[model samples]
Target: MTATKRCIRAEDLYQIRYTSDPQLSPNGKSVAFVETMIDEQRQYRNHLVLQSLDSKDLTSLTVGAVRDTFPRWSPDGATISFVSNRSGTPQIWLIDAKGGEARQLTRCKTGVSNPIWSPDGKHIVFSSMLSPEDSFSDVEGESKKEVQKVIVVNRMKYKSDDHGYIYDKSKQIAIVNVESGEMRAISEGPYNHTVGAWSPDGEWLAITANRAENPDKQHSIDVYLVPFSGGEWKKVTKSKGTFFFPTWSPDGKKLALIGSESDTHLHAAQKRVWVYNLENDEQTCITAEWDVQVGDSTIGDVRSPGHPNPGAVWREDGKGMYFIASERGNSGIYHTTLDGQITQIVGGSRNVYGFSLHEKAQKLIMVVSDTASPGDLVEVDLDTKEEQRLTDVNHDLFAELELPAVEEIEFEAEDGWKLHGWLMKPVGYQQGQKYPMVLQIHGGPHSMYGNTYFHEFQVLAAKGYAVLYTNPRGSFGYGERFVQACCGDYGGNDYLDLMSAVKYACNHFDFVDETRLGVTGGSYGGLMTNWIVGQSNQFKAAVTDRSICNWLSFYGVSDIGYYFTAEEIMANPFNNPEKMWHHSPLRLAANIETPLLIMHGEQDHRCPIEQAEQLYIALRYHDKAPVSFIRFPGASHELSRSGDPQQRVLRLEYTADWFESYLLTAEKASV
Candidate 1:
């Protein structure tokens, strides 16, 4: 008798743990990373973990009901500074890398973020929230529990999906002395100042902010260098578009930047890497000819914390740098020389989400993920580019579960464009039996569905449904032009690309049941799902999560709707209402013949929940197609990934049940 393995269920979400922000020690002998998991109380806990390379010993720096993140090593590696809410509000906390009780570093009223140790290791530079009316160093002991009972929205950028309601607040740079715990604001102004990197000399700090005359109307951000001793900020890379995240070279002569030209086509512009020289005050586009978008733009079921994604790391020699780019369905680390030569350093069909490098020790640590794994820490050889798996954080959870095998598929569209995607087979599949297939679409139309492990896909496979997901032309990983292709052509060719993949799968894969097809996606993927079900009756079931049905209204309600609607659909609602409505899925929602499920987060500001209300109401007018709406309270657009643990599970349960009940039970009922 053969033993069968238990398939992964929706409840497995709680069992999955997320590890990130891996910071190598100054001596490169140890690494400090944050591991986040759902606690017994149904809340999330983040703890700092330290592991030594010599003895292979791992230790927890901090533990218990709190979030300890953004760990940074001191110059001597004696202490580690992190931001934690253990004391009721998030502030800088310090702990010995050797393991001991953590001591609070800063007790600022406004929460602190992105702690960076100075070169001398005497001071730490961080940004904290401050009201527009408050001065830069407003450290008056105001109660942290002051609730904003009423929100007065004056600016166009009043609310955002990331920070919710921070219109009245600005993020200003502040410095905290390590020894005495004395803190003072460095760069103080009405505008926000995001810390990027410190000069090797410790005299200058690179930051980006929108300090324009009319910051709200301006779409681009400027990179500026502020003095550590408190002086006037100097505008560095005065690029036409929004460029940030300045990585300083070892010699501090040049700075590596990732941004796009915002002077024109702000919406369709692609993120490219550039190098700005301090001596001549000139910037060179390093990755412009590479034709790929910079940074890790891969989409998955797991949503990382608000920490900025890992960017370019300057070489010690200052001649080149190592950066991550989305290329052909995978986010790979590549090496780019100042002379415009590019080489793939750690190239593969894998997602390298985060990495840390130490030149003197010749050591490199990478946080990697693929189809079979959520994420794990690995050591990558700097010279040979060889990788060694260092941590198996999810090995125990994965050992007890049977995960469906994920395979990559590729086919050429009618327009001769090669499309890339992956397919997850139903768990415990029979050789000759067919199963219902669900077409999964990813958001970002600019983001690619690549090597990352998706918990949502596993849940569907556990329910005996094959999941098919693809990166259409508009998706990243392919190239700049491919991503921009979907800009003005919302549902035009991108919709066809999805349908062609579905047709190809049904014809080539005998395991898929053509008549019992289902489709689901979130964000832009959700919009595509709504479009698919509305335009085609071929889909028997559809689930749209945090989707937009009416682009005309989406232009006003969404955080970035005003610009995104114009850039994405190429139609300003004010100038072209007819065109915006024409591209909107709401125009076809009443024509949807498939049973639909509208899933949304009430606090979703990206694609506001109002979009869901409009979608459900439009479908209600017909009432022919069975439709239902589920709202997750206090959940943002990331409800599927990092929302409340219970709510996340409920989302997966609802999505899986709706597809199973309709694709199978409804199919049998008709028989």
Candidate 2:
């Protein structure tokens, strides 16, 4: 007899392989992409993989334990430009499409990223952070000496999450010649600059920057263009809001961009598609009435580090362009005309994270993922919407495991607002059997819990527990008003929305045991988890990661605390201390009666580790329920998503262990 498939375990993370950044060749006959996996050392290994569209033959173009990503095909498709760190730091590298040894192109001390070829393919443009006095050729080898220097902070945005300090270096755009191996800066200043699209004629390159005198205090990031010969930059937008990912039209008369006009509450602002007419200098929002956020906003943790959003893929005829959009729970490909008409090119219950267009073939190669599927490259016919699976990086591993299927749930909140969510029954579940349910909340509060593969949820389901996740009022994909509704009302209506969903799930689902309930989330979700346990002891166990306990402290400590707290909560410590304290989860610490497990990254500047420390001490000081804290050394806010592979696995194991300890019976816990 054949053996039954085993349930997915936390260690299955090592067996899973991720593929991203699919780049279709100029002729639309082949594809070059990046494949990533964890090696024996628990470090990430990425390489370029080339495959023919017709034969489906796969070949690795570059091989190393180091990262090789952001593959961009040259104009003639003869060579591919990619970013690699084999020599110590990331730099642009070129390799022939067919095969051969790759050649390093840039020698900048600072690493480069977002590498794109000029229209003529003679030069590759990339962005890098460099000191004001440093040039592309200032490649001085560093001395292996350890020293401690006092950190001087003059800017409000000095410390960030992953990149600790940002006062010394600024992002600049530069170009490197493929043949001469020479590099020159196109735009330079003590300001951040990002590479956009190159004009079809290769005369100008569109860039995203904020050259305002006080950019640190402003939210206006506009588009600009610099000539190939390198001179003054001509501002394209009026600097009214945040704009980026500018793509030039085929005729070079227009530029399609994805951004928002809101300056203050950008996190709640809807990402819309806009068009700029260079001839008349008119800017219009094309996706204004679409009621969908442009670009892929679906949140998932399965993919590798390098997933670039391929902004707007202009059609060959230049009448319209293809872009990714999110609505409800799925993010799909959409097409819009210059006149504002829109159509769905590809719609599904999945997340189209990235895609590349092949104008000649009338097809697009997309990196797509859904619940139960990590992600894979898919070829879709634009007209018919017919999809063909291209690569299966984790097919073998998935075939041996039994993954839970998500059941979409639509229920009304307490205030009559309809909310969307998903429920996953325990693995090997039987009808009429009671099971402990864990409510999983997503961070970003602005981000959505969509139909994407989340390993953490799968691990909980495998532990014989039902997993419930929902996109509450503050989540994307539900229109602008719904997403913005939870901003000012932190633990108010958003709290009610989550509790209503849990109540709905328990009332509707027969297998859910209301008495044995648990809650967990990270960041904003963590804040909400803290809020939920304090408001009522409906939950028996809770796990909060990278959470915020005190709003007053977070307003001063977090990287974006200065602006985020003011904008999201509609109050600051100086102006409205009482409101901030009233909304803070720390104020309700004495009411927490559930067993809690707090997890945080030591290096998390976004939601500093001090937030966790404060909460742990407060709970113990109040002598409430049991509380435990776990600090991941050297990890950042991205610990759960892109931290060390081993730590990510451990996080899952710890979460499951915590939930099991509190919610499960001794008989089931032992099993």
Candidate 3:
């Protein structure tokens, strides 16, 4: 009998690609999306591509090293506008829909993003930072240098490593004449404002603003109405919570906004859609019991809505609104009436991102994705609920590879609470032989591991390891109560839930070898792996990536240390250092017996490389286990997703080698 492939390497992983940000033209004759490709040099870049409705005559609009995204069709569908950083900094660029050389629209020293064309297509409104010198005043009596000194940071989480430094120059909404290039700030203040939509009548522009004295401290975001001609802003709604992403109704009588209750933790917050009446200014929550959040943000603000694409659309008659909500285990598009009744319009195996509705043709052009495919463009008939795939970006990739099958699993925690997880067995398996198991952990104890296409998980299964991942108590997708379970108790119940998943997988799958188990994860998952080996020696080997080892030091060092340690974990560096140390994995390093490999980015401000250094030093000092540390230069916390391509490939290869040496071969394991 021939033996199955003992282990898979990084080179064996399939090359899968997908498209996103699908935008349909007003006439419904053509569709556009951001097509991402790995060049011959292995560098990732995206460009705008157009495809006709009737034929597959695809055309690439933007080219070269520049990455273009967020393509928005003009009101008349004559032009397309997008944001690109090809010119050193991200700026707005316009190109004719038919085809021509793209023209630069904005030339500010800082940068501009999210350009929205007015109703008449005569002007374009976008968010950007003006120069600090522009805000200085010329004193009457003294020279301009005599003013008192003040440091200004406009928005909450001003010092973001990923987005760079945000100054006192708030991202005010600026409008520019499409023809003459004349520009004016319609909504101006020390506060930050983002444009939502322009009323059909062109009298008012709907916008979202967070203008509190301490914008960072205030969790609530409010929507406002600003005159198109430029004047005082009118407040539409006020609350202790955050409210944003204001979309105007077609008739201009009502406004739709995404609201979140708080920011204690990712799961502790409740997100919903609310409609505000223009006359009474009364806000009604449309998603009261849906247990779904509507927006996405890099920072921890629950109130800030995700960037609006064609996903949220106003009905042509203005009697109803349509938005995408992730509930019932998947995200789907739903239409809600004025009476607060919601009807599911599109239901399927894939998640609906956003849709462009053509009322005249009764057709809905949307971006959807399943577990196997990354994402693709599709069209659905709103009336008939019939769907058809439009793009085949990943068809060849899927056909050539044998992907792992993911199944949802539920297991009871030690405390009788049920937990959710996803399990992926080897692609080609036998009945009698056992396979090595790898417990994969996700970052953001609050981030959920859903039915999505995860390249890492697929690659691991292809390498002959049965992979298991779970969304512990603090993960999203479940309601508020399920998420708050991990607030102050980080390594407590969440750790137990993961332990229970491992046990369940071992008991149910006879092909899993309990003795040859290996574990790996990044970010929060990295923290868990560190905590796991320190507490138990059940696993033969472990790898932790960008993990947190010492909480006391993290509180003072990390960018979000001050807020996250105090608000979320409810711990302080001065008073509760012991509790923080007790939860830290470094404290229990002496008990760790498994051979461990630690990987981190050199410039990760979120969880600095010192965290990995502390763990490595502790393990080596005690002489209890073999420990190795690898650092990627100039890399950040997002190395797994957006790191340098060559470095990312090496990182994955290093992780697989560590596991293969320890778990696959007994001779290497003993050494």
Root-mean-square deviation of each candidate, in angstroms?
1.9, 1.7, 5.0
Model 3: residues with Cα > 4 Å off, grouped in runs: 1-15, 134-158, 166-170, 186-190, 263-267, 295-311, 667-671
- Write one digit per residue (lDDT tens) for candidate 2, span 1-671: 01669999998888888788899999999999988888888888888999898999999998868898898899998999889998888988889999899898887787888998988889888988876657877663563335538756677777778576666677898888889978888877668899998999999999999888887788688999889986777899887778989999999999999999887776888999899999999899988888888877777787754469889889889999899999998999888988889988888888888888987887799988899888889998876778899999998998889887679999999889999999998998889889999999999988888888999999999999899999989999999999899877999999999999999999999999998999999999999999999999999899999999999999888989988987799999899999989999999999999999999999999999999999999999998799999989999999998898999999998999998888996546668
The lDDT ranking, best first, is 2, 1, 3
Q: Point out where model 2 deviates above 4 Å.
A: 143-148, 666-671
> Please, what's the RMSD in Å of model 1?
1.9
lDDT of 3 by residue, 165-210 (tens): 4555566778878887677767556767777888888888888888
- Per-prediction TM-score, please? 0.97, 0.98, 0.89
lDDT of each: 0.84, 0.88, 0.75
Clashing pairs in 2: none
lDDT of 1 by residue, 176-268 (tens): 888898778776555777888889999999988888766666777889998898878789866479887898989988888889876655645
CA deviation > 4 Å runs, candidate 1: 1-4, 135-141, 144-151, 265-268, 666-671
- For model 3, the run of ten residues with the poorest summed lDDT: 296-305
